[model samples]
Target chain A: MVSFTAGDAVARRPAKPGRLSRFFFAGNGAGYMFLAPWLIGFLGLTLGPALASLYLSFTDYDLLQSPRFVGMDNYVRMATGDAKFAAAMKVTFIYVILSVPLKLIFALALAMAFNRGIKGLPFYRAVFYLPSLLGGSVAIAVLWRQLFAADGLVNSVLSVFGIDGPSWISNPNYSLYTLVVLSVWQFGSPMIIFLAGLRQIPQDMYEAANMDGASKARQFFRITLPLLTPVIFFNFVIQTIDAFKAFTPSFIISAGTGGPINSTLFYTLYLYQEAFGFFRMGYASALAWVLVLIIAVFTAFSFLTARYWVHYDE
Target chain B: MNDAAHAAPPGDTPERPILHSVLIHSALIGVSFLMLYPLLWMVSGSVRPADDMFGGQTSLIPSQVTLQAYKTGWFGLQVSFGTFFLNSLAISVLATIGNVMAASVTAFAFSRLEFFGKSFWFALMLGTLMLPYHVTLIPQYVLFLKMDWVNTWLPLVVPKYFAVDAFFIFLMVQFFRGLPRELDEAAMMDGCSAWRIYWKIVLPLSLPVLATAAIFSFIWTWEDFFGPLIYLGDIHSYTVQIGLRSLIDSSGTSDWGALFAMSVLSLIPIFLIFLFFQRLLIEGIATTGMKR
Candidate 1:
């Protein structure tokens, strides 16, 4: 069947020189006509700006002045001199590490629970997904700030327990964790994805496992976990990338300062501060390149390590 | 298949005991309530009298409901919140239209047409999906600034018209690929132009994907904070997010009622979208494996 289809496709290809030329011309013309907008955007917006930013990273370009080439000074300064850079990196890494795994775990557990033939699955799914839809909005960040305030609902709840709670948003030691909680609160999307992934696993697998006297836990480990690895890997990479780019909650919560001693200064927030707040465009460009590199390395690492864990049916 | 074969036994029958079902329901209910607590608190606080907003009141029910906060929050700032809403609506609508139009055509080209460097361009397009926006942030800002587009919606809306959002294109491409080739082949036999085929045939059949892209684009653009915060300097031009942020800066927790009121108001459009188009939204996410 495959060879037949291959032969059919080859036969359909334009064979005569004149016909082939006409095919090429007409195809290219129509294709380019349809692709004009994307082509323009690709060249003018994406590729052009990317290359310009790369060049800008090595120069001292404030908004007013033309770029003055400064070689690797910005990169060198980031490596050796910038305290806030180091602090931002620490806070962002902590956020990504704490939030992604916790969110995925919560998502997977809830997904498994929902997969157990629960009633009103759609209702529960919608209720769970509400947070993720609204979570990235500025209002949610504002709500988060108030929720963790000293006299806010959290403290009020803690008071009922006869325990005093420090101001989670204001206290430097706890501020980043508040943001982490905020990220984990929006685990709804991943949970939904996991639910979809769960549905794809054949019921026959479980039926077979049950007949073999495999315990529920053993069946999960032996069947579901291995099957769900691809989805897990996908969620891991996407969530990590997203967590690294997290800015709005930290921005609104920190009031654009990333303050209380920069405890919640996300890496993107720091990049924004450098680019817009201080107009240190060159340094900010350098920071942006570093971020791109970091994401690239992480993505490449994920793909490389995926072979060992991410099971696929061939 | 026979009815008996079709009606297979439920897996893990022992686990489906009444008590187990009860436990699962109760656990989900408890977690759901905890998840929604903050939002409920915000809603309750928004209605409570300004004086009653503080002093650690954690109740979901207000002592007395008043429209005072809504009244104050609407006209609170130098420019009323109505203006911000209008601004956000205009931007989101224009951006969504532009994104759907541009992405559809681009996806059609990739899915239905053969051209030189097709695979290479498709690969590049996908590469952009994983490229961090930060890499282009500074240079784009510079380009827009040089064009005297600062404090305007041009920077936000124009690139979308150029199909800068590769995710939408990728989504449409996936959908377009699933469309039967026989339809296009039949159309071509009738002497239909590629444009006509895309416009008259393919697009009508692609309402689901197109609607998915439009809904997501509008919601994401409306929720976007960083773009408006950077580009828009004038309060009159503030998006809903910027206006909400400014309200916080101005109020500084002194007027929690008004802040919460405005916050609630900011979320209403998104809430309405979720309430209405939920099925499409869920199907979109499930098929694409994407989150907005």
Candidate 2:
């Protein structure tokens, strides 16, 4: 590390009496000073709040009343009695399952297309990436609502073909699908990562495959895909975590309702409702901890599974 | 200028080149439309009258254009577009500055310095990248709330000084690592301190990557709705996205034209930043990746 090297360098240089030692100490002091605000923030803001939330989760803290130690009552109630929580879980799981795969495919497909020595590459890259940059914001969520409402642009477009389209955002059963589509549309970030990975694949491999009379499709599947696995795995892990924690769109589109029938209610959205909306901070803390556990388990599972499929070159 | 341009095709049909060019252009054009359509529609809808904004009667050009929506949205602090823009700008600019300066120092330490636990510390930083931001949200929120800092910009900009975002650190580290060590070594031989070397020599050479980090942090923090939404309760402190969300009253009937107009305006700053810094980002990525 820089700190140790600088210390040694100071000790070795015998210039002024204790000047080098003083400089070394000064550097360390400066580094710590620079880190002070964040350290304070972490200890006071982050760590303290985390502990409070954990303690509160085991109590009956309704914001107004002094928290009574209820000892896992919130957990038991959520796990056993809360059907809405169950529905939210189901919706979020379905969303993660549906969105993650489709988003990966879309990103991968676009990345591959762009990788094929396209002209105006930067222009295309910027254009495609703009959506992801805008995706999770309230503005985009509102746009999604308008784009999917019965009298909205999508349905109206369908009307031109004499095919009536359903109200995608308003229909309880179909509402979640609108969110899924939104997820798929914001494929830019993963696509950029994929593009970077694709460039790392040796061009010589393709040349050799071509020499062996391999078709483009065969080369892509045999060479491009296998080499791209590590990046795919990375994207998968990040995107899955992101989709599970998705909140803004559902919150905005549903108008903080989590309905037409709680179909569009994501896990984070529900947790937020419990914490802020309903003032059930204790229950929300439990829900937050559950989410962390779920994500950890899923991430660990993927990392474990990566050995079978993810092809790390080195 | 280059040998590839003049190199003749080996045993290829004359028509192959022309056909390939055609195919590539056609595909590019098709893909371009797919990327541009939604944005084009959004822009056009902002100008179009409500009746002409939707339907089986969609046109590439609006039948009637109006500036009334823009006038109403921009000047009307009733919804507070001006305040929100300033809020987003302040948060994003401060966050970007913190990210650039702090990330550069941390990355310089990791890449160039040979201190104790260097690898361990580096790995620790990388490990933090794997931990989802969601895991830290509850704790971070509580921390700020306890300090009575929840409704302020402190929560948004302050933690960035700690190099909390390992991605930016990783990015800058890669850039710093790619720089020739001879510069620092030569400076050291001339009795230059490490801080002086970083400030004068390395930092100057790292403008490209720093620009990349700055632009990225600006765009990401600018568009971050969640942080502003949770931390800032007062309407005056709402960022553009949150402020836009507030426009939709409980009745569910929002002024569509005004919303879209504000959306278009909100996008301008990001778009301009992207246009300015994009070349630097592309060049930095290409050179840095190729270095090792």
Candidate 3:
């Protein structure tokens, strides 16, 4: 059993000045105590796996057998020998580059359109935002596959216009485009961010511009565009990271094949195949490390460049 | 124009402009149709008789509707979706409870308490936010497998207790930071323990943000398929998403109607939650974005 002193409650009072000097030490110790779980997860789970992968990048450790340290073997294989990895890289880059910019443009445009005083604005915003919430799920990816199939809804609609649609998810050449369309369709989250940014723009500026006979286009370019750049930069960094980490759609749509001759094999999907499918844990670990480095490099580069472009109100 | 602006607000009249109202309504209606089309198609496709599912044109309305698909889907497969919904609900609720309690407690410490390694630990927490789950998935799975947690809700629920989600913590911290420190100082002057202040003061005032977190967590967990798919291999343990996927994979003849019905049903909880918490969610999201 526990016993409490009469002054246990009184002990809650603010520490004395002499003792307060030790507050940082006391607080730091308590803070670390509070952070213990996350720190343990980081050091034990994240750090261990991360370092293992980096080391394994130099080895050939298929899951069943012991990993043999073959320095630079996997890197060499990737750099010079592996053609499919290169193909996967190309497909992923194209998807990211095309989808990211288009998504931003669409989201920003729609946000601007909806930012005007409109009735039932919430309903409209919710409608546009729904697709993004559903975007990354297996069900949505399955829905994408069904919608783009030869005898599916898209083709059925196309048939009315006397034009036949290609097998969207099946055709290697067209499959990537379908995925790009899928990415654009789920532009809701970015649109929400843009909407939030739009709301922050003071109405007085626009009114002043209107009084000065500034065209809507000119007003957008001079005021709205410059002011919204920070939000845009924020969205760009997040979307780019998300796009690079894309997995669910390709996994579900391809039925784990990544096929139609390996068209939709995303980086993370390929990493899964290596680790889980081929039992190449060591190589997969190496790939994982490479991905980390790539993400870090891209993120660092973005931050380095952000100084020139991103504007802060304060 | 200057005289009119001085006399009364511009665009203020005895009544709202009929033309503007019409234009707004029309635009909203048009966008609503676009937003709801795929979902509508999914519903219609799920209910239509097998022969009429792909009958001809992409009609928004179904030619023939039947509940036979739902009937067959429920009992046809060795697995049933009723059980799957139960699985999803149980996991979602447990995860939500764990997340709210653990996240709020930790957020309290980070926000209100003066402690050592506060900034360093907070930075570490934020750093975890940027680390993609893909990097951790294999190891996490391997860890679970070794612990014999596979095919159990343990894998799904345990992380919630540990405050694995930095986003929620960050959000709650921001919410708690907005609260006045005067409350804590006054409570201290009156000899109130930190825990008491957190319980009596912070928890009560933090309801709005907590509600926001709860709503998002429930929806996210409900819709989550990947974690359940990877961890729970047993058919009996399948969540709705996994159940639907398995149905599609196992059925000799695809039952589009039943799949669509289940999909519609699956979206219900999220929509209902949104309807109930719409204002809170809107304000929460708006404020969080603005604060950032």
Query: What does candidate 2's lDDT look like per residue over B1-292, in tens digits?
Result: 2234323435556677667767877886787686667677778888887677654655668898988777766754464688889999999999999888888888877787665455766676676665546556665665577689988999999878766776778888888888998998899789887788889988999887888888878877887877887899888788988777777652254566777787788888877876777666545434432100
lDDT-wise, the better of 1 and 3 is 1
Interface DockQ of each model: 0.79, 0.32, 0.37
Give the range of the ten consecutive residues with the poorest summed lDDT in model 2 chain A.
A33-42
Give me the candidate number with maximum lDDT.
1
* Residue B50, model 3, lDDT: 77
Backbone clash pairs for candidate 2 read: A1-B114, A1-B115, A2-B115, A45-B143
Residue B270 CA displacement from its true place in model 3, Å:
2.0
Q: Whose TM-score is higher: candidate 1's or candidate 3's? A: 1
How would the docking of model 3 be graded? acceptable
TM-scores for the candidates: 0.95, 0.87, 0.90
**Where's the lowest-lDDT run of ten residues in candidate 1 chain B?**
B1-10
Local lDDT at A107 for model 3: 85
Kindly state the number of residue pairs that clash in model 3: 5
Q: Write the residue-wise lDDT of candidate 3 on A2-121 in tens digits.
A: 335536544654456537756666556655665666666567666665565676678887655666999988877877888778877888889899999999998898788778766677
Instruction: Name the lDDT value of residue A84 in candidate 2.
Output: 90
Ranking according to TM-score, highest score first: 1, 3, 2
* Candidate 2 chain B, run of 10 with poorest lDDT: B283-292
